[model samples]
Target chain A: MRWNYLIAGATAAIVGSTSGHATTYMTPAQARVAMFPSAASFIDRNVVLTPQQRSVVQKIAGIPVRAPKIMAWEAVDAAGKRLGWVIVDRVLGKHEFVTFALALDAGGAIKGIEVLDYRETYGDQIRNLKWRAQFTGKRHGATLQLDKDIKNISGATLSCRHVTDGVKRLLATYDAVLSDHG
Target chain B: MVLSDCLPPMMPSFQIMGELERRCRPLLGTFVEITAPHEKAIAAGFATIVKVQSLLSAHDPVSELSAVNRLGHRRSVTVDPWTAEVLQRALFWAEASCGAFDPTLGGLMAARGLLARNDSLLPLDPQANWRDVHVTNREVWLDRPLRLDLGGIAKGFAVDCAIDAMRAVGVQCGLVNAGGDIKGFGPEAWPVTIAMPGSREPLAMVELQNAALATSAGHDASGGLDMRHLAGASPAIASVTVEAASAMDTDALTKILVSATLKSVVCLGLAGASALTIFVDGRVIPFELKEPTA
Candidate 1:
């Protein structure tokens, strides 16, 4: 249940951010505590899937397993009673990377999900001064502010389809691997 | 030793600066991001958005909006004050635009497979329009069986509510963006970029100060524009971006401009909003209302 390493890793990740678009919403430890406030302990139950297990997961999830390793934690109460499980996973958005934590209750139903990090890979192109200069003082007659980062965008809404699909895959992971665990 | 060597090494500071905090979560079928100076403010903002979604989401059968849709034709369904307020605004825009921005198109959207159809609900009346909806106090009643989808304006209302939540927490400046609908308020201007429909290409950049901005695009599958929410919209227009004092107005105005009837200009003037429309042929038009003479 010690969370020193988790705090350290989170600090390192935040300090390493050079791009403005990458946002870290919560540390792994923070997310665990938020998802399971009553848990007395969190046991690291990270899994490494066998080839057969991977295929099973892919079949159940209807999505290809991108990796064999999965980061997971098992929550236990003060009386050593099993509470739930938390699975950390990553999925690619259309032009971004989303890292999220999906929590499942003891009955294998989804408790909640939280986004840990969101990084827009396309952010750099818009930040380019040359690319932005083309629209400067254009026919739109709106004042173009060039020096600031494109922190907010107003355009067609982007669906959270990737994250939803990622949740489905993680749920299948639960049904395939963690469902039978003690 | 050089002058720089005599001084300390000019390395970038690695310490965390406690000035700004940003968070993003999936809500209202899209990612809602909030940026504020304090963590509590951001949390409050997201909490408010969650409440609004629970009350107004048509996708959730247990929500008040779904309840109204399921039984409004038969009985007066009571809704939360916030839901009633948004419904009132929707009616206002619907009236101003002369059916160009109808909220009763939910039946058409369901028929088109844009929204899930509930078999248990009463049969929809194709003749139902915004005029069929009646709102008095917190009660909403439909003159006929018409599914009401607030998808066109609810996100903006959520954004506005989130901003108010942030302000309640003593947040001086903050921004709330639900998908592409955004509102920012503070002393300094928030810089935002406008992307082309279905692409990340930068179309324009504008500074929003204590204002709201929203963009609506035509049916472009690749662009991720859910044109199903719009009624009688012209597909020839690529996109329309509106700016107003409130996010709800901006959000509804974008849809009004996309439909583009003669009354839309009057709606823009009455709402104190302006719009920028990008045509499919790459023509950009700005609609600025003339000042009324005293």
Candidate 2:
């Protein structure tokens, strides 16, 4: 479409309203979600999941999609080691917009995941269905560096990182909430 | 010969050539017609053409064109085949520029006040695209709204054209030296010095034959590096050299080679010319004219 482009390059600062929500989580997003829940809901009311994992979380919460942004629960076992779970929500930075559910288990491991929505623009990053299968049998709380541990598709660096960023936020939140609760 | 006829009565034998030696203004924005005796001498004289081509330098932001129906929509005003030749050779420089040497930057040039004869300048419509211009052998069409200025490559092309015009005017042995874009015709033994600083003391002098040679470099009178064109292309090179079927090819090739590096050099070689590239590291990559494989 050869539409007219009348827009000039703008230099104004857009003061984000969500700055108040970002707080003391290890990740910027955790800071965001903790400091400003009311504003956080404006953007990240979503997460990423896989098929087998989707049904796992959905069966637990009964159609996980409609669950109001959970102020999810967390805690470690008697050993006091790194272990707990939180169902935090995040979105991908990929041009491909795929949103879904992600769940961590009691040992702070990946319990399951299920994609609620998916569409792609280019090479499959999470869509080739590797995210769930790779996490299977893997312990929870593993650092989610997709390039090192997960076989993220090539030419899909940002897309792959988007999913991992989501996972990192979820884990950090679990760490935060579980430490406080325990 | 008395100097009073055209000069002060105190000077010795002289007319046109002597006056020219005393003052050689940068030959830009002026049309030149050479009137010299002897063919090989005229062909060898193109070393002077090299000097004039350097003055067209100004900052024009755009990916310098490599070839085409036209460099960009702004260039649709004329065929500028000579410009097309230089743009094609300047690929090396384009590689250095990372896209700054673009001929497609007609809009940017207009904004920068670098477009010569820009009195009728009008801001391009927002919808203007480089691809809008259509060109053919007979005419070039600038559809809708597009303004192109070939200020970058025009001097080199004029240099080359002047060389050809020199030959047609019965110059049996001479050179067209448009500052640095030089072409030699007739005889194979005139001495030429490629006086680029730091290359060597003798400056890589060559025996001029039926060949074209261009070296990309110059210094202002104060010895300050005049890098206006070379920097425009952003090549990883301080200089570039090109030898082709014609002087025009060699002249513009230096600019293209400054930034466009691999893409443009390969393009020149593909189009049947002998080309070589000198990197900033002093590494030289040479190309031989050959029929290209798909």
TM-score of each: 0.81, 0.41
Leading candidate by DockQ? 1
Q: Give the per-residue lDDT digits (tens) of candidate 2, residues B93-204.
A: 3343444444445555545543433344444655654344454543455564555444445555655666566666665544444445555565433334343222111112
Candidate 2 segments exceeding 4 Å error: A1-182, B1-26, B29-102, B106-119, B125-130, B143-146, B197-202, B218-226, B230-232, B275-294
lDDT of 1 by residue, B1-294 (tens): 011212222221212224667778888888898989987898899899999999998888899999999889999998899999999999999998887887887878888776789888888888889999999878999999989999899999999999999999997789899988999888776767676665444455566778899998732444334566577778677789888888998888888889878987788777677777877655556666666211
Per residue, candidate 1 scores C-alpha lDDT tens digits across A7-86 of 12222222233443556788878788878899999999898888998899899889988878989999999999999999
List pairs with backbone clashes in candidate 1. B198-B223
Q: For all the predictions, what are the DockQ values?
A: 0.22, 0.00
lDDT of 1: 0.76
Best by lDDT: 1
- Candidates in order have lDDT scores of 0.76, 0.39
